[model samples]
Target: MPVTWRDLLDIFLVALLLYTLYRLMVGTRALNLVRGVLVYLLVWFIASLLGLSTLSWLLGNAATLGAFALIVVFQPELRAFLERLGRGQRFSSGPLALEELLLGLSRLSEKRRGALIALERRTPLGEYAVSGEILDARLSARLLETLFYPGTPLHDGGAILRGERLFAAGCVFPISESQIGLGTRHRAALGLSEVSDALVIVVSEETGAIRVAEGGRLSPPLSLEALRERLKGVARA
Candidate 1:
C-alpha cells in the first residue's frame, strides 16, 4: 500500500495542529494531558489499522466521553487557551506606551534607583509574574518610579510590562550564573532575556546608568533618546 498524497496531507495537517496545541499548552499542567492525548491517538490509529473493529469502536465512543471529561477537568486551562487564541493578534505597543516607558526609565535612572523591568513579547511570562504581586495597573512614569522607590514593598524585585499595562511588580526573575561580576539585578535581567523573547531594562543604582538586555546580551549604557529608538526598533521587529 503506497502512501497517497491525501495521506501525506492528512499527516501534515494533524502534525501542524498538534504542534500548535503543544505550543499553547507548554509550561502549563495541561501539558500532561496533551501527552496522554497523543498516546491515545496513536493507540487508536493502531487499533484501526489492525482491523480491531471492537477496539476501534470502543475508542471512538470513549473519545466522545473523554471530550466532555476534558472540558470539565481542564476548564480553567481551556478558558485561558481560548482567551489567548482570541488575542493572538498584536497591535504595536504604540507611542503612548513608549512615552510612559521612557519617562519611567529616565526618572528611575536619574534617581539612581535599582530596577528590573521585563517587557514581554512573544513568550508568556505568567510563571515569573506569579512570583510577584499582580499589579494590572495603568503604565505611568510616576507609577514606575514609585514602585521602585527605596524601602517600598514593591522595590527590590523585578517588574513586568504586558502591552501598555504594568502587569506585575515585585516579580522574581532567575539569576544568570553565566554573567560574571555583575550585580544581582543585571544578572536577573540577562537570565530572563536568555529564556524568553522579552526586552529587559535595568537601572544601575551605583551610577544611575540605564541599560537593556535582549537575547542574552546587555547593551552599553543608553541615553534616553537612544533608549527610545531602541524600543522603537524592538516594536518594529
Candidate 2:
C-alpha cells in the first residue's frame, strides 16, 4: 500500500491513543487489566492466523465484551480523566486559592502541627472520601489544623481537598498490602499516589517530619522551603 496523508493521520492518532493508554495504566491496578487485554489480543491473532474460525470468533466477541467490562470495572479511572478534562477553565479561575494552599502549608510547617494534606490534581479522591466525614468547607490552614489537632474526633484519617474546598475529613485511604514496610500513614499516602496524580503530603505526628508522595515514589523528609519548591515545580509543569 502506498503511503498517503490518511495513513499518516492514522499513525498519528494511534500514537496518541497509545500514549493516553500508557498514562492511564501507569501506577494503577489497570496495568494488570491492560496486560490481560494484550494477552487476549495475542491469542485472538494466533487463532485467526491458524484457521481456527470458531476459537477466533469466540475470542473476538470476548474482546468486544471485555472492553465494556473494562469501562464499568474502571469507572473511577475514567471519571477522573473526564473530570480533569472538564476542569481546565475552573483552574484558571482560582490561581489565588492555590497560592493560598501553598501559603497554608508554609504556615502549618512554622507551627509544627502535624498535618497530612493531599492536593488533588487530575485524580478524583471521591472513593477515599467515603471513609470519612463529608465537610465541603473552604480550604484554609486554620481548618486543616483544627481537624488534625489532638483530641479531635476526625484527627486520624486524611483530609481530602478538592479544588479550593476541603471536601472531606478523616477519610480512610487504602493501605498497601505490599511488603514495602511503610507505616500506616505512608501506606495510605502511597495507595492514593499509585492510583492518581494527586500530590500527597505527610506530616509526622511524632517528629513533624514532612514528606511528599507522587508518581508512586516518596521523597525523603523535606523542610518547608524544600516542600514549597517541590510543589512549585509540579504546579509549573
Candidate 3:
C-alpha cells in the first residue's frame, strides 16, 4: 500500500491532539489514569490481533463500559482541561520577578526564620487571604523579609502573592492532614497545594531548610539555586 498526503495529514492531526491531551494531564492525578487506559488499550489490541476471541470480546465490552466509567472518574480533570482550553492562556502566567522573591527566601532560610509563601495560580485564594491582614503591597525582598521577621505582627501566618503584588499576609491556611511530621508552615503549604493549583515555598524556622509544595507533593529540602530553578520552571509552565 502506498502512503498519501491525506494519510500524513491525518497522522499529524492525531499526533497533535495526543500531545495536547498529554500536556493537559501533566502534573495531575489524571496522568496515572491515562497510563492505565493506554495499557488496557495495548492489551486489547494484542488480544484481537492474536485471534484470542474470548479475550478480545471481553476487552471490547470492557472498553465500552470504561468510557462511561472514565467520564465519572475524571470529571474534575475534564473540567479543568476544558477551563484551560477556554482561557486560551497558561493558568499561572504572571510577573516573573522571582529574583527578589528568591533573595528574600534565601535570607529567611539563612536566618532560620520560618516563612510560608503561596503563589496564586488559576485557583483564587481570596478565602484564605481574608483570614489575616491584607498587605497588598508590591512584591519586594525587603518587604517580604520584614513581614516574616520574628515577633512581627504578620510573622505567624502565610503570605499570599498574586501576580506582582503581595495580596495578603498573616493569613491562616488550611492545615494538611498528611501523616508526615511536618511543621505548621509545611503542613499549611501542602494543604494549599492539595486543594488549589498554587505553588508554595516554605522556609524552616528551626533547620533553615527550604522546601517547595505543589500538586499535593513536597520536594525535599532544596538549596537556594535549586529553589530558584524550581520557581523559574513553575513560572514558565
Candidate 4:
C-alpha cells in the first residue's frame, strides 16, 4: 500500500525514538558493531526496495546471521540497557538523599579528614567488593563518619551506595597506574567512573575541599552545600 501523510508521521516518530535509543547506546564499545549492522540492514533495505532480488536475499541471510552474533557480542551493552529501564530517564538516578551526607562531609571537611563516597549507578559493584570488607549498613551520617574516622577499621577503602542503601563498605577501589600525582581518593574516583557510571564524591584531607567525579570527569572544588546540590542534580537528571 502507498504511504500517506499519517503513515509518514508514524514512521518519523518511530525513527526518532529509535534514534534516541541508538544515541543512548552509542557510548559503549558495542556501538561500532551496531552501526555496522545498521549499515548492512540499510543496504539490504535499499536493495529490496529497488527489486535486486539476489543481493537482497544475500543481505537478508547476512542480517539473520549477524543478529545471532549481535546477541552474543552485545550482551554487556544489552544487560546495561536492560538494567537502566528501571531508572526511566537516561543517566539520571532520581533524587538523591543528601542531607545526611552533606552534614557528614561538612564535619569531615572541618576536621580535614579525607573520605571517598562512591554512589552506584547502573553497573553492579559486587566484583569490586572482593578487594575489601563488605558492610551492608543503612545509609546515615553517623555510619559514614564512623567508617571514615581516623584509624577506623574501614577508613582506607571507598564506600559504595546503592540507592539509599549502603551497599558495601571498606571497598578498595582499583587505582589507576597513571604517572600523574593523583592521590588515593582521586584515583579511586576515576577508577569507579571507569568501571561504572557511579558518581564519586571526594573530600580532600589536605585541602578540605569537596569534589564530585562522574563520567570520568571531576567537577571543580565545591563547598559542602554546593556538593550536595550538585549531587542532587546529578541524581535528578
Candidate 5:
C-alpha cells in the first residue's frame, strides 16, 4: 500500500498514547510492572525470531495470562488516572496562604513536635484523607500548630492540605519502606510523595528539623525560608 498522511497520523497517535501512559505510570508503583512487561515482550520477540519453539510457546502462553493479571493489579492507578482525566487539573499560580503554612510549620518545628503534612498538587490525596478525621476547616498557622499539638488526639496522625483549606487532620499516610533508620514521620512523608505528585512536609519531634519530601526523595533539613520557597514553587508549578 502506498504511504499516506493517514498512516503517519495513526502512528503518531499511538506513540502519543504510549508516551502519555508512561508519564502517568511514572510516579506510581505500576512503573516497575510496566518495565517488567516490556522486558518479557522483548524476550518473547527474541525467542520467536531465534526459532526457540518451546520457549516462545511458554512465554506466549504466560503473556496471555499476564495481560489479564495486570488489569487486576493496576486497578488503583487506573482508577486514579481516569479520575484525574475526568477532572482535568492544571497547576495554578493563584494566591496561597503560604505564610500561614510556614508560620504553622515553623512553630511545630520549634516545639519539637513531629508533624507530617501532605499538600495536594495535581494528584488527589482524597484516599489518604479518608483514613482520618475530616476537618474542612480554615487554614491558619494556629490550626496547623494545634493539629500536631502533643496533647491533641490527632497529633499522632498526619494532616492534609487541600488548596487554601485544612482539608483533613489525623490522616494516616502510607509509610515508606525504601529508606532505613528514618523516624516514623519522615517515612510517612516519603511514602506519600513516592506514590503521587504531592509535596510532603515533615517536622522531627526529636530535632525540630523541617524537611520536604517529593518525587520519592527526602530533602535535608531546610530553613524556614527554604521551606517557604518550596511551597511557593509548588503553587507556581
Candidate 6:
C-alpha cells in the first residue's frame, strides 16, 4: 500500500503525543509506572502472538484496571501538569533581579546567616504562605538581607518569593526525608524542591556556604559567581 500525506500526518501526530507523554513522565514517579505499563504491554503482546489466549485476556484486564489506579496515585502530578499547561507564561526571574537576589545571598553567606529561600515557579505556593507572615512586598536585596539577619524574628524560617515580590516570610518548609546529612535549612530546601518545581537557595550559617536545591537534589557548595550564573539560568527558564 502507498502511504499518502494524510498517513504521514497521522503518524506524526501519534509520535508527537507519545513524545509529550514521555516528557511529562520524566523525573517523576509516574515514569516508573510507565515502565511497568510498557513491560506489561510487551508481555501481553507476546502472549497473544504465541496463541496464549488466557494469559492475554488476564493481562488485558489488569492493564485496564491499572490505568485507573495510576490516575489515583499520580493525582498531584496530573494536577500540576494541567496547571502548567493552563498558565499563560512560564514564571521566571529577570536577570537583573536575579543578580540582586544573588547579591543579597552573598551578604548573608558572608555574615554566616542561615537562610532558605524558595522561588515559586509554576507551582502556587499560597498554601505555605498562611503558615508564615505574609509580606507581599516588592523584592529587594536589602529586604532579603534583613529577613535573614541574626536576632530577627523571621530569621529562623524560610522565605517564599513569588515572581519579583517577596510573598511571605517565616514560612516553615517540609524537612527532607533523604539521608543527606544536612542542616535544617538545607533539609527544608530539599523538601520544598521535592514537592514543587521551585528553586530553593540555602545558606549555611556554620560554613558560610551556599547551596541550591532543585528536582529533589542538592547542589554542592556554590561560590557567589556560580550562584549568580545558576540564578540566571533559572530566570531564563
Name the candidate that leads on lDDT: 1
Q: Give model 6's TM-score versus the native structure.
A: 0.78
Question: Model 3 — TM-score against the truth?
Answer: 0.64
Tens digits of per-residue lDDT for model 1, 34-148: 8899899999999999999999999999999999999997775666566556543222578888898899899889889999999887667788899999998989999999999
| Superior by TM-score: candidate 5 or candidate 6 | 5
Candidate 1, superposed: residue stretches over 4 Å from native: 1-91
lDDT of 4 by residue, 50-109 (tens): 999999999888778878888886565566556554453222333344676777788888
State candidate 2's TM-score.
0.71
**Model 5 Cα lDDT, one tens digit per residue, 43-70:** 9999999999999999999989988888
lDDT at residue 206 of model 6 (Cα atoms): 98
Clashing pairs for model 4 are none
Question: Which pairs of residues clash in candidate 5, taking residues 3 or more apart in a chain or in different chains?
Answer: none
Clashes of 2: 0
- Each prediction's number of clashing residue pairs: 0, 0, 0, 0, 0, 0
Clashing pairs in 6: none
- lDDT against true structure, model 1: 0.84
TM-score to true structure, per model: 0.63, 0.71, 0.64, 0.63, 0.86, 0.78
Which 10 successive residues of model 3 have the least lDDT summed?
Answer: 87-96
Model 5 segments more than 4 A misplaced: 1-4, 68-74, 88-96
Q: lDDT tens string, model 3, 1-237? A: 999999999999999999987766676667788899889999999998999999999999989999999999667556656655553322242444577888889889889999999988776677789998888888888998999999998999999988778889999987777736988899999877765677898999999999989877899999888877787787777
List candidate 2 segments past 4 Å from native: 32-114
- Candidate 3: Cα lDDT at 118: 93
Query: lDDT score, residue 91, model 2?
Result: 17
Best by TM-score: 5
lDDT of 1 at 218: 89
How does model 4 score by TM-score? 0.63
Q: Residue 6's C-alpha lDDT in candidate 1?
A: 100
